[model samples]
Target: MASPARPEQNRVVGIALRLCAATCFSFMAASIKLGYRHGVSTPELGFYRFAFGLPPLILWIAWSRNWTAWRTARPLAHVRRAVIGLSTMLMGFSALAYLPLAESTTIGFAAPLFAVALSALVLKEPVGIHRWSAVAIGFAGVLIVMRPAGSQLPALGLALATGAAFGVGIVTITIRQIGRTEGTQTTVLWFTCLSVLALGTLLPVYGRAHDATTWAILFALGTAGGLGQLFLTSSLRYAPVSVVVPFDYFQLLWAVLLGWLIFADHAPATTWAGAAVIIASGLYTLYREHKLGRDRPKADAPL
Candidate 1:
């Protein structure tokens, strides 16, 4: 692949893959939601996702012969990411089962907002005022979604989504820490290895064995998850983060549509209303970042 042509091809591929990732992620949300009703524990469900997904990854590694990337200095960072990543995955699965997909995914999208705050704290980066306001509005949106005083919302599911968002946010932050020194593939590979090991240990003791249908859903969960991450990562090769990053929010639309058309999960009026706030606020933050430009330190500056 020549340099100029490679970039052009990558852009086309990136868009296609991201669209695919969005679809896969939405389907995964639906699958995990359905799987939970079959009495499958989160840990066990994880094992199925990772274990089934492992062979393809293994084959990719063998073909590429990039074994040394796994031994980077930040292996421990990868471990931390995996732990948080696993929690995020499990909580998401749990939320899907208990809450409407629209609500579950809408709340889960809060991770990016958390990412903004985490970048400032852990990265010691400067945040402009506009982004700060976005963070505030996004949280308010979250509160609206939760509707704490009202009984109509599913409290447990919302809590799970919050936990998942935080976990994923931490994972994202930690990735920034480690990814600077390590290849993304190395980081992701170790994450999968650590997560599978962690969950495998937990499953035997506490996980309930699932039926065939449950297993199928679990496989879909793993496949969709792996593919989504792959697409998202591949997308960076095409455009700058500023251009491609915001496209991530498109997942919300996919989730809402999938919930209604596939899983029969519908968002409450409040959920949609709050989502608008979150989106509006989040976009403001991105716009701030864009204005700040290349010279401005990223949300995660070096500690």
Candidate 2:
């Protein structure tokens, strides 16, 4: 088991991790966006993305030649993480298929909003009124972007994306709890193990490959996504999930830009407005956390 990082370095490391993860997720989202036009279903794309990427990860793990950290005290928990992760990817991609990329990206940003609530309940973390209020405001923005009341959208897309967020919160808290006993690399390796194995179950549906150009895009997606996971794991060593959570909304900015360039969709007024509200609320949450710290904590210091 890995020890907790010194509290002084937590926030610094966490922000770096969040920044990298945001980029990786944005890259992956872009790839998924491309795949959408190519007629690649989410499941098929995910299978290819993970499968092609695994051999290198495996070789790297084997080259390190130490299985000690790779072992987890709670194997079943890893299984659960894998399942939830698969659910998250599946739901997010499914949303991508139907919704405009920016809208899907914006709604998925609600994962942090979900995390605020879940962390309080499941992890028993102390979240002050300001954070709670931020959560409420964030949800209001989500409602505006989703406009669930205005139309009969696909219930499954909304439900699955939200459920995926709930699952993301669970995975996050689980990683935190387990971190008390696990090294960052060990934690990452184990989760990757479980994720690959679980995602493998969909092999039967893994469809035919597209042209070589599409293959290149998927490969880049896997590489960037893997690097993103690495940065995130390292950042968690220094910081609390709460500190890094909000930056994830940054992905929507990339999504919107990519949607415009690739799909030729002009940003609607509501999409941009809802995005501004969400980003504002998230910034407010970060401000409160930073201000309350009084003494500025190390970027890598965990809360």
Candidate 3:
């Protein structure tokens, strides 16, 4: 039998891990933007990012010696996830090129709200009124962030970022469905492999890295992305979704700090206000889902 305090300890560690994941992902976004500034196109940056990440993932697999994990009964399912995942990466990186990091990160908070809507419309999953209300409020928050009338950010950038969030939501759904029969390693490995292949094809037209420093940055970008994903996946293994999901909000803090420190970019007051609304709505939706017994660990797929 386990001690009473064991669960609490796990929850604490899980929250810490989740926070670490958030920080790593924030830095990854910053690196992507940095790479863009150095003339790396989105496709090239994304390809190298996944390509460099392969070594670490391969090493982890070798260490675990789970060769069977590499074999999956549902190859097509993995391909589907990879396609959606690639779309998410393209939209996300493209958004980073056009928008400030903090704003892009804040807009990403809409992912869970999108998940709620997608679940209802596509999955035919039951969502109660409270969750629906939260979703509506969350979209309103997005509009506030957009502030179309006087917004300085390009409309295309906002659309791309929002689309990225929705793409993440779709990925989340696929992850949940695929997770029923697949392990984390399988899902991640397949996605990385597929993304590399898909993104690699565009290298002939868009790829360019002229210096050692640029090459190093591209490698670091991929490493950070891979490690951040590992950290997020590990966190859920230790604690329930309800315990660590909220800590994902920490990404906003890291984003704000990184944007200010690295790029001297500051989000306007409106962005912060909208972020608060989105955060509240996301938390409440999670709460309502948990309360209604509709929440599951699979629902905590990383954005």
Candidate 4:
């Protein structure tokens, strides 16, 4: 029999996988921006993102021999997740189309902050001062990024990105509710399949012919999204949630680099500063959760 890997080896593998997942997601974000620059509509991009992602997930389910994962008692819950999550996806894509890559990305990081408040209010989860403080600090970072009085960021994009974050928060709670009776595979698979169906119906309304280059970009976008989701799911199999999730912030670095190099979009210093604060606060929040015996993954959604 093969020897089992050491705990340290598992941690290293998990961290690497998490970093790869972040890179893939960051690449997907860049692809969305590039697709828009190539004249693709947000709805079309949203449609393809889920449609192409479905195959990989189906293959994964087959490979795992977990066909039972397709069974779910909570069809309505899946519907709610799919509808809300896809709406958030479109909002994020629109934000990418309108805002600098880094800014849109940074705003998305506020999901956990929103989750903190949502947990307290919606879930009736007790929130001590530590997490509440972290949430306050995290929002302060968001405000810094927003720079409400003298902001150069596009107002529409900022609003959309913030809305996406709040949507993510709501989705997080719904996921928690679903988790009470459903497996992760079931939730993810159902969401993707349902989203593909919903977005597919809109294809006639939003789809248009594209040049070969744009078509290639769309394919790349979908591929990156699928690979990112797979990597994120695989990482948790090797390591604890706390150990892997911190690597998610690596997406910010990838976003800054890709934005600057590909789109000539530079993130201002405030973006970096605010991102630092947000990341720090999020880490502290995670640490508090870990210490309190809570082990939920920070970045649960693929996008």
TM-score of each: 0.87, 0.79, 0.93, 0.95
Model 1 regions more than 4 Å off:
1-10, 59-67, 207-209, 294-303
Instruction: Judging by TM-score, tell me the better candidate of 3 and 4.
Output: 4
Model 2 error, position 39 (Å): 3.0
- Give the per-residue lDDT digits (tens) of candidate 4, residues 1-303: 222232353988898999998998999999999999988998889878877777877876776767787789889989988888888888989999889889989989999889889999999998999999999999999988998888877899899999999999989888888888987778998888888788888889889999999988888888889888888977887898899999999999999999999989888889999999999999999999899999855334835
**Cα lDDT, all candidates:** 0.71, 0.67, 0.84, 0.87
Clashes of 3: 0
Candidate 2, residue 146: lDDT: 71
- Positional deviation of residue 171's Cα in model 4 after best superposition, in angstroms: 0.7
Summarize candidate 3's per-residue lDDT along 113-209 as a digit string, tens digits: 9989998998999988888999999999999998888889999999999999999999988897898998777888888888889888999998874
- Candidate 3 TM-score versus the reference: 0.93
Predicted candidate 1 versus true structure: per-residue lDDT over 1-303, tens digit per residue: 111222453556656656776777777777777777777777776777777666656654555566664667766677777767777777777777678877776777677789889989989878767777788889999888888885476778888889888777777777777767776667767877887788788876977756787778888877877666666655666655566666666778887887788777677889889888887886777677677774221221100
Question: Could you tell me which residue pairs clash in candidate 4?
Answer: none
Best by lDDT: 4
Candidate that beats the other on lDDT, 2 or 3, i.e. the better one: 3
Q: Point out the higher-scoring one by lDDT: 1 or 4.
A: 4
Best by TM-score: 4
- Kindly indicate the candidate among 1 and 2 with the higher lDDT: 1
